[model samples]
Target: MLLETHVLQDTDPDLPALLADGFEVVGESWGAEFVIDGGAESTASLERLRGFVETARAAGLEIRELDARDAAAIESLDAESWVDVPTTPATVHVPVSALDVRDWATRGRRAFGALDGDRLVGLCVGAAGDNDFVVVAPDQRGRGIGGAVVAAWMLGAIEAGERSFSAGGALQNARSLAMIRAVGFRVTERWLSLQRP
Candidate 1:
């Protein structure tokens, strides 16, 4: 049997007592995920990310709000994008199927995508409940395309009257964690994963 756990960024200030136990560390246990506060007021970080996305758009990357139920658009979510995100080898990457996206729509969620001409360079979904998931093309990593897609999603959610939002990601995924914070999300909790003998 296999077990997983997570330690959030907030707990980095002081290692929790549980972490000192005989849990074998396992190179950062994996369990819970980071929760983001999307309803956060506009801050310098949010403004900066928005500016970055706009600049990228000016350079020809088009950002558009997507209907999660669109079969063709859901089919466009690239499999390669998921593997491209820099994450610990321990991170589990799941495939997104069109049926999964249809489920997103059933939950009243909206999706967004970034296009470079006719190519789908990035994609994300915003739940009416304020949860979000974002992905960017392999060739487009570190270029703020993911951030752009997420920012666009947030804006659309705001228009739809969503006053609060949150998302989860592995703690080992620093790049993504940075992007989430760059958009004004603060870490709110820490979880520790422990395996039983």
Candidate 2:
């Protein structure tokens, strides 16, 4: 799946090479960033995300950083969530393994989840860098869980000295786009996907 696994910049030298190899544009994904210290606009964006977190808490969703114990549940949730999703832009980031989840939990405080009782109902996490990938369970969506987990993760990221945050997804993914925008990120980079037809 290397054909679709990457998002290439508009000026990437590999664009010509891929085209020469019979690859054609199949889809596009956009990259967005939030400048933590950008002043009033930044404050307003952060307020929105913080508000979502408050809403989630009022609804009794517990947002916390993931540890090793959350690995299995998060992995299971990701695998199951993908089963019903119909190939959205974020699908490229799916099928997260337990090992990877553990790595994120054990390394930087990058992975976080929203819990409903003992069940992990939402997740937002990334590697050692910015918290990029996020997913909320199908049944638990629309109640601000996605935004809450992301907000929780970003709060931690900022505490850990992450001055700016980045996120990306398919160009057509309105759900993910809406969530990111609710925070403070702006579309800063866009890249296309090309694959063999």
Candidate 3:
């Protein structure tokens, strides 16, 4: 298994060293955050990670993962409803173009949407994993949409033989934190970063 962590802009410079030390870069996301995965059982590797995290914190950074679900409704919601909302500066928005829904549908990952009298009010995007659903959506704040979508997503994940789910959010987003907690997710770990120019 790979130990995953999120790194910020100031921490980007340290990524090469971490990679050289055996960490694999999994994904580079928006907001200058990068996800790195590594083996957790090696003591020398772990110590190197400790130093990296401590340094990242000293420069003001954090890392974490979310409770993820794999469900049909998640994908449905995303396709049917999530497209209506405009991405704001305060929110983590994934443009619809970023996803290839036709491909996802064929892979057994279901998409879901929230309807308000035929108008799509919200959407949830999710993919099926071995043990969880990787879900993302725009209807997470004050509405009950987040919980509903997640419940639906979890149902799919469970049926698919996934034991659990995971998701992620930036510490700076209070709304996201509240929504994630409301759906029975707790912080599994903290990640720090050091963004550099």
Q: Rate the local accuracy (lDDT) of all candidates.
A: 0.64, 0.77, 0.42
TM-score for all predictions? 0.73, 0.82, 0.48
Per-residue lDDT of 96-125 in model 1, one digit per residue for the tens? Answer: 777777686677878888888877888877
Local accuracy of candidate 2 as per-residue lDDT tens digits, 16-135: 988888877767777888777768876776687778788898999888888778889988888866654434333366478888776764565477889999999998887544665788
Q: After superposition, how far is residue 9 of candidate 3 from its true place, in Å?
A: 13
RMSD of each: 4.8, 3.3, 15.2
Cα RMSD, model 2: 3.3
Candidate achieving the largest TM-score: 2
Instruction: Score candidate 1 by TM-score against the native.
Output: 0.73
lDDT of 3 by residue, 75-192 (tens): 4554544344332222344533324454566666554443344333334345663221223345433555444444445444545665445665455555545555655455554444
Order of the predicted models by lDDT, top scorer first: 2, 1, 3
Candidate 1 vs 3: which has more TM-score: 1
Better of 1 and 2 by TM-score: 2
User: Which 10 consecutive residues of model 1 have the lowest summed lDDT?
Assistant: 27-36
